[model samples]
Target: MTSDTAATAATPAAAKSPRALARARRRHSAVRFWRAYRTHKAGLIGLGTLVVIALAALFAPLLVGADAQSVTDAPGEAMRAPTGEFPLGTDQFGRDLLALLVWGARISLTVGLLAAFLSVAIGTVVGITAGHFRGWYATVIMRVTDWFLVMPTLVLAIALASVMDRSLWTIVVAIGVTTWPTTARLVRAQTLAVESRPYIERAQALGGGHGHIMTRHVLPNVMPLVLAQTTLVISSAILTEATLAFLGLGDPTVVSWGGLLQDAREAGAVSAGDWWYLAPPGIAIAVVALAFTLCGRAVESVLNPRLGVTR
Candidate 1:
């Protein structure tokens, strides 16, 4: 009975050892990644900017009351320039520009993140499938990807948005479906390279099924490219969302950076010389896009030192 109890305890500890090792390895990799990431000043700055923006968006309600968003209860005059009473001034609707910006960040960032994730998920799966398989299967997938690649992504997104019910999710889906081809192309190339490695053949020799080989070997090898592409995709997603919103396809009920720009245009902020109304959202969009680009470049450099060296 004592021996059986000891064996049972040992079995659980042995089972836990793999998980504990995996956790330790992940921590070590994260530390290494951070250490390398610290060397890129521009990347660090961009990352800091994103972190600040994310925190502000997350805590927007705490920072500004909901009344700030209420046009009927607006506390300031319409199109007022930045003043002590209202730091960013008021919008055309007499709503506080500062508050609008804070809330807009939440929508913009959420759409960007979710849309990018959807795009990458679809791309990764398609890329893996196309690269892992051969014959007609690979040909069909590649042809479809090529078709999307040749087509104007913005036009596709616009068409999709035009037909859908105007909502946040509609915008996300439009951007996600239209933008995945680029990532698919990228990931397919990486998968092809990974599958060509000797270990993939060894896995095949060991009787690894297609699913096991793809998930365990091909996916892991291609993940670095996927990670790098994700940052770039996010930037594109945000830009697409803004474009759709500017064209009056965005959710009318929600405040977003692009919606603010559209509102500014409708109110004739440019004609009236209300730079305050026009500048904040435009600047925010540009700054966030640039920040994501900077971060993507940094991640690419970290993952592929050869690119860094060439640069």
Candidate 2:
């Protein structure tokens, strides 16, 4: 009888293990989303393109022996069509277009990544506090966000970057500071939804502090939204950097896409039928941005099935 009872108890515990695993499997739906996303052709291509661009930008010097900033011409190398020496071609200034494009990835990636990180950091804190706390803190945070939202992000960045000697760091800070409102609003909505969930309420009732509730209970749920927003914002930041460079506010010191375009314009590449100068950087920007955008759209579809999901 003792052995029978022990066996029966052990069976229930063993059965409960399966049930617990099933529940955990259901709770983390990210795996399902990834599995679904993998089947998406655009998602896979965009991901691949992004990886290639990141790698090229990171290892431009190693990948291409030609200096991105150096205007080199071997007389034979001058304005050469896409050949072994210049896979992409040479610029109007006789600079290696391929080298410029490869190096420009560094600037785009830097601006995008740094700005996105800053926006997320500031937005997450303000958003969590505002939504979870729900008081003057919330009001103040939202109102400040409102003020930022009203300001023209690109225009503001132009003004700020222009005034600060037009350095890479200046552009990074300017873009980061101006482009956080969208993230804050998105995160705040997610935080609010998370705070009202049954688990969150239960945590609160179980003597969890506000900080503990926000960090432990709320953060995990809202992270998906943050991640989705990150890809999209990085795309926007890259474009913004290009725009700054186009408008003569780009760092002349670096061979970024914007600077490449600027050099083309100055050298009259388009007017002179040297489409080589204008096309490469434009294509580079479009390619990188398109990759991010495609991935963002796919992630958005998964994260927020309906527009009402507020991720």
Candidate 3:
């Protein structure tokens, strides 16, 4: 073939080479991850439960229609026991227990996911910085992480929540800030491991800048661990928000699992034997938390083969 003919032929092959190979590898890895996750019974159950809860939260208004927003205790409905029309019974305020719980799922899940995202974001930045730099910055970052580690998370969250305005965002911020240290430590460990690898050394030798290397090389390698940690963090964040709300620091206007518990407590449900009002929200919290925990553990097992946890 002539020079121009050969060059034209090579262009098509080269155009599909690296990008195609990279995409294939990504697809293969995703398939492998899914295969592993699917075999995990607890993980599947957790994922299913979460999906159901998420669907419920998304369609809560539709589920209960206008009654979801209506005050239930207005006339004859106040503190009524579970019956055909009102499945889960009525709260002291006569709100349908089922409706409240459904709506509460939206608030609870929103706070959980968003707060966890915030925690993960902060943790990833700090961890990546500390792991890549390995100097004074590293020292400062790890020391701060350790300090947060030493403090009681719940107590610190309470103190932080107390200082902030009692709102959903305040609850989210309080939970997120207090919860990031664990994630930071986890990410820092993974980053250190990735930073020391041969590929990373090669990237450094090629004069790749810190930002580029950290984002491209280190971040991708540590993402599996970060993802597993994020699942666990979501569960923790939910519980923490609930705790803060139960302690009377939660936003009063917003309905949430924690708020439900708070209302139940304040209504003397414990003394009145109102199992209908209290059990649903508490059970919802436990089930959702358990779901996340199971899925997180499965992901951790999949990512870290050394654990050798059987599906």
Candidate 4:
């Protein structure tokens, strides 16, 4: 009995607790994901670009003082050509264009990330619910989703922004609520595919409730799709915010890429032949959008190998 007890005690902790095993699986999955992600050159480039841009935005205060935005504390003469004193030159307000660009990145990226998160959260919930349930409930949810999907997202966002207060959060909400329909549709399709799997059926047969089935079985499977979609959504959100700002709906108190363009237009940069004022913001927007697109495509390709054939 003593020997048997000793042998039993020597056994390796019953193959680790469920929590430890889950953590190990997660670590393994992360390794695999990184291995696949790094192989895509475009994705790596995009990620590096974003990292640099994000770091700059995060450290904007240290790079340039807040006085850079102050008209009274202008750093250089207005509309001066690029030189050693001001690489990007000064805007009509005599604020440093370089400083504006740096600060603008902070606002643009914040709006993009927050708006995308809100959009994804709403879409994921609505989609999973609609896909999991049946009968009139599912029909109603899908009809609502279809209605939003059919309407022009930009128009809806414009209308919402028009009616609401002009602030950063207002823009975030306007973009988020209007943009969710696409994500909802994508997630619903993915959810339906996941629900059709044998494991889901087994889960249901084993007395798993709706919450259990959806959260445990369905959500994990669809998360990769959500992640990829989120990156794409962020690009769209940034573009939308820029559009609204350019249309004179942005908060006047803040500096954003879109606001810079608006200021240039109002300041007659075009008539004055000031390309520096127009080019920097435009190029920044395009580059950031392209970076997000590349990253999204890479993630999508990694998750669905069939799509990577062309790449």
Candidate 5:
């Protein structure tokens, strides 16, 4: 009896070892998204670059060891290329370009993230509402979205920004508002497809509430579209915000990459041979946007597969 009991215990332990090993293998598989993320190599590189940029942006203050608003007391002058201390060089005002660039990253990422999220959130709600509920409700929601689709995004954003007193929030909101139409249209299409599935029909037969059916079944089906759209929107929002900031439509109080461009342009840094003043911010915006575009496109192609794009 004792021997049989010990054998049973040993059998259970032996069985668990393979299960643990399988679980680890499963986890390892999930991390290799790049292996299947082909069809957009540039996008992958861009995505990777953005990740690095975001990390640096997040850690900028610690890296600089200085407050963003605090000016250096040193009698520093501007238009110089990179030195050991200020790798990116100083602007006309003698503020450390490295520090300002790092600080500016915070603004760029903040606008990118916050504006993207707001755009996604608003678009999702409008899309779902229009798709799941037909008749005049859908017509009204879609007609509003049409205005967004037709209007020139930058011009509309400028007009909106002009009214809001030029704060960071104004930039964020303007970007969010203009960018939502695409997401809404995508969501509405997805919802239309999902609402017709047999499972949804069964749920309706069972007297499930509209909220429950939408939340549980319809929403999950549309989520992939939402996630993929987020990457593209983040980069787009950042670029738009930067454009507004550069144009003097942005809040004058805030320091953004666009604001830097505006300063550099106003100072004639390019004509006067201050390439350092103009290069970093432009490159940063381009790199970040390219990264998102690549990564988003790659993931979308992989998931949808029928797009037939080559690796």
Candidate 6:
């Protein structure tokens, strides 16, 4: 067969095997994303730090050799400074500060991740639906999103948490629901841009269903932004959870970084100048928040260079 004939024959086989084509496309996109990602060194560092924090939180109990909830005074052990045995010292309640911190890390990170995922899921759906439909539906959705945008997120979350039972899941839901408007607006804007492209028009012309076009085309195109937004959401969610915990709205049963801070405050750690009691949790929050912010900025810069974000 001639070269042209061979090429035509392969084209039909290629079209017949969509899974192979899809795998190839995915691999290509992964490579492209990695290339873009490597250009941001700070982002890589932030990602590394984030990973370390996660691992530390996950293995807290094993590393500490004690349950965070365990109270051990053993005669005048309360509020002691760091020693050979207790690296982070003890709280006023005689719980190991290091153990509490480890457990707190787990809770804080879990809340951050779960809340961000929920927020992003809601935002992506609302955004894609509004942007793709573009009519009265879009108008209504946008208006609702705008209403959310106008509301004070922290205040709304505080109100929701105050009304609900204090639990980890409740706090997560409160933060997630309150924080989605920004992601929705961002996704909607990106969806509008993606939908106007020629490929989307061609897909529509080819009789692609709304579901097919959105899931296969528009979502992939806008995912980088969604991912970037999710990272930022995680940071905000963590902060929000901490704030709620500080106000005594945290799950009373669970130990979280915020709860530790609350415990310290109530115990007069600040006034007593007990750095051991006060510093670790505060530093943990700051470090984790900064890591997420750095990673988010890097992803945002790589995916949307038009925003003109610098390192």
- What digit string (tens of lDDT, one per residue) describes model 1 on residues 30-92? 999989988989899889999999999999989887666777898878888999878888998
How well does each candidate superpose onto the true structure, as a TM-score? 0.93, 0.84, 0.92, 0.94, 0.85, 0.91
Estimate candidate 3's alpha-carbon lDDT, on a 0 to 1 scale. Answer: 0.89
The candidate scoring highest on TM-score is 4
Q: Cα lDDT for residue 12, model 3?
A: 78
The per-residue C-alpha lDDT of model 1 at residue 138 equals 91
Instruction: List pairs with backbone clashes in candidate 5.
Output: 39-311, 43-294, 46-291, 47-291
Mark the regions of model 3 whose C-alpha exceeds 4 Å error after superposition: 1-13, 17-22, 72-76
A best-first ranking of the candidates according to their TM-score comes to: 4, 1, 3, 6, 5, 2
Model 5 weakest lDDT span, ten residues long: 67-76
Identify the runs in model 4 with alpha carbons over 4 angstroms from their true place: 1-10, 13-15
lDDT string for model 2 (1-311, tens) is: 99999999888657777669778777677678888677667878899999988888788878875555665442235555677767778776566777778888888789778977887778888888889888888888899999999989998998888789878888888888889888889888988887777888788789999889988888888888888888888889889988898888877878788888888788777777777778888998998889998888778777767753222
Stretches of candidate 6 off by over 4 Å are: 1-16, 72-76
lDDT of each prediction vs. the true structure? 0.91, 0.81, 0.89, 0.91, 0.84, 0.89
Task: Measure candidate 3: CA RMSD.
Answer: 2.7
Write down the lDDT that model 4 would get. Answer: 0.91
In order of listing, the candidates' clash counts read: 0, 0, 2, 0, 4, 0
As for lDDT, the candidate ahead, 2 or 3, is: 3
What are the per-residue Cα lDDT tens digits for candidate 5 across 33-130? 55677447766687778778888878886887556445555325666678887788888877777778877888988988899999999999999989
lDDT over C-alpha atoms for residue 172 of model 3: 86
